[model samples]
Target: MRKGRGRRAVLAVLFTAGAVLLLGPGAGAGAGGPGSVRQDGERPSFRLRTHEPHTITPDEGDSIPPLTPAFGNTGPVAAPLGVALRVTVTDARFDTIALDTIPRNCYLAKYHRTLICEFSDAVPAGAAYELAEPLPKVSGDYYAVNGSYTYSVWPLGDPPAHTEDYTAQYERGKDTAVGLKPVAMSTLKGDGESTGDGEDTGDGEGTGDGEAKGGGEAKGGGELRFVSDGYADRADWGIEGIKLRGRIGEYAEASIPEPTGAAQRVRVEVPEGTSFAPLTRQEREGLPSEIDYCTRDAEDGNIYCSNPRWYVTLRVRIDRRVEGAEGRISVAEPGNGDTNPGNNTAPIKLEVEDGPTSIDRWVPPVSGFPVEHDVPLETAGSDDLASPPEPSVISVDGRTGVILLVAGASAVTLALEAFRRIRRARNRGGRRVTP
Candidate 1:
């Protein structure tokens, strides 16, 4: 009886070991569990997480203490990893501090609302991966308050496996007063419409058709205004010219701030087949002397100008043509203090008027060639056709050459008349003509 009991115990132990091997880590244990092989047989399991600040407050510039996100591999085997970060803000104005500074491996998608990052480095099991450089600073308008921003990180190609705490409340502090606002007009002149106090309504209101009302005070004590006239005319010779203007004003309520090293500028982009040309002395007659213009480069299609007198004008010429071409005009690097950023850009459309193109104007029609004319050539010199004038070589130019050319033409005319007469006579007698 002792031997039989020992054998039964050994058999039960063997059975349990077999069951563990067949059922994986434990009974009822799911795939993706610790040390468990996935049913689909993918090599890596990832734990991605997003770390966001509890509260964000807009400062004079970019906010400090940016969000940091990370991902880690949990499986036993090392494998390539991909990460996707999605930051949905309460307002469209809330965005990363600078888009150009994002990681090289990361790319913006879904209208810049998402970032997909694929790591080139192999992710070793149990190792965490976080951004080496500082992440973007989350920013919002000065008036943005109590708005929430949510962010989530997951495997790049998989979304259902996101972390449990994917969405969190992002608090915005009280409204910050300093900001920049830009206003644009489709034409050079703004309509004579202003509030009774000659100031904008402070609502950032404007027409959607590329023209906007004036943006109130250059908040943050900045006094310069950059404006561009968005009209381009295509000349008959296929070149276009544009004129840009600027306006300067004082902030009576607040003193104008001193110019910083990163001074504001107006940037104009010429249509593709065209480029910016420096204005000639004649063309710069009425422009303000304080406004400095960029030098001309044929290959460069952009123009940059600065300074803002009460009425400053800058003229640029685009000496090439591209049909139906459109360009953009805006203020570059508006800085972090800007309050309103939407009204900064306008469109430049090249106008093509009704008429013939340059091609039609230069080339004459080739139809109805050798027109049948009733007028006949005179053959009065037929007697001199017995021997056609011997060919002559002349190297002289000018009036002497012209006289020789006229004499040679006369001899050729006589020979052609003689041939015509002989042909007519032979045709009447059914014989070949020899001239």
Candidate 2:
């Protein structure tokens, strides 16, 4: 009877142990718990966080702080328009670094450790700077171990608009440094109207209806001519000689002498209703000094000289038929030579009697220098697109096996306790089990 009781007690304990195992923590899915399901469906993600070493938040009304003078081993440095910095760490031993500084509004963290440092405004436009060595690093007790870094900065704003009428030439050295070369005598001509347009009536020689009949010559008999000394001294560079002629209601023509050999004569017909203004030698230097002029009636406009080396002479041939129409030509100097070349060279004022039957004028080109450097060439092939690697699970703790062991031990302990209780109950009821 004792042996049967002991066997019954043992069987009761064994049955209780099995029931506990099937009903406890992980029993809902057999070998799979909620944690397992979550783990199987999740993926890994990463983020970056950065912080400045100093605590300096400017007040709303405070001006930006003056930049610290470049410190550390100094090489070459450019002034920065602004700076963005990122700091990151990867080891648990250095996690304290994250708490040492405030993360900028634009940063994040990954795995509670890794820190990414991005520094913009490292260099500035027009100003040069130097760096003696890589940014200083904190080690051992502070943050980051064996840190490595790289950086790049660009000119602060879009390349200044290239509107200076002068073509830019770039010269780049082996180190990718660039320099500018300027050409001053290049000219760009735009489209003009045809000779049939009723616009170019000569000064005061028009029939009052914007028309000049054939043989309707100027009452004041004079020829218009341009004169210039063929020298391009820095002070008086823009100079050229030419003549313009056309009938009213028709396109005018510009006849300029070529730069080479006694200035070869070339004629180009411009559209009618076109006005003309000849730039002075000073105003034609390049951008930052380019001059623009316009006129209501091209035939009577006066071309003023910006430099001492150039001048336009409009000779009027007064005829009996239009003698009552007084057409006087005047030249206005940009007074005192102290006026800002930019403002002093505003368009000249001209008044015509009936408008010229035709209008035309000769002007020098604003650009005439070879580019100093070749423009950057395009890449030969399509850029390679790199697909991001698929994310994989990464255990936060280095010893993942230890965590698994701990979980298994806890489950076993729970089963063992249940079995012991059952055996005690069985024994009290005259039933016992043996292992």
Best by lDDT: 1
Error of 1 at 274 (Å): 43
Score each candidate by Cα lDDT.
0.36, 0.25
Residue-level lDDT for 34 in candidate 2: 12
- Runs in model 2 deviating more than 4 A are 1-81, 84-240, 258-273, 276-435
Q: Over the stretch 377-407, how does candidate 2's per-residue lDDT look in tens digits? A: 1211223122223334544553565555555
Q: Which ten residues in a row have the lowest lDDT in candidate 2?
A: 42-51
* Model 1 accuracy (lDDT, Cα): 0.36
User: How accurate locally is residue 46 in candidate 2, as Cα lDDT from 0 to 100?
Assistant: 10
TM-scores vs. true structure, each candidate: 0.25, 0.15
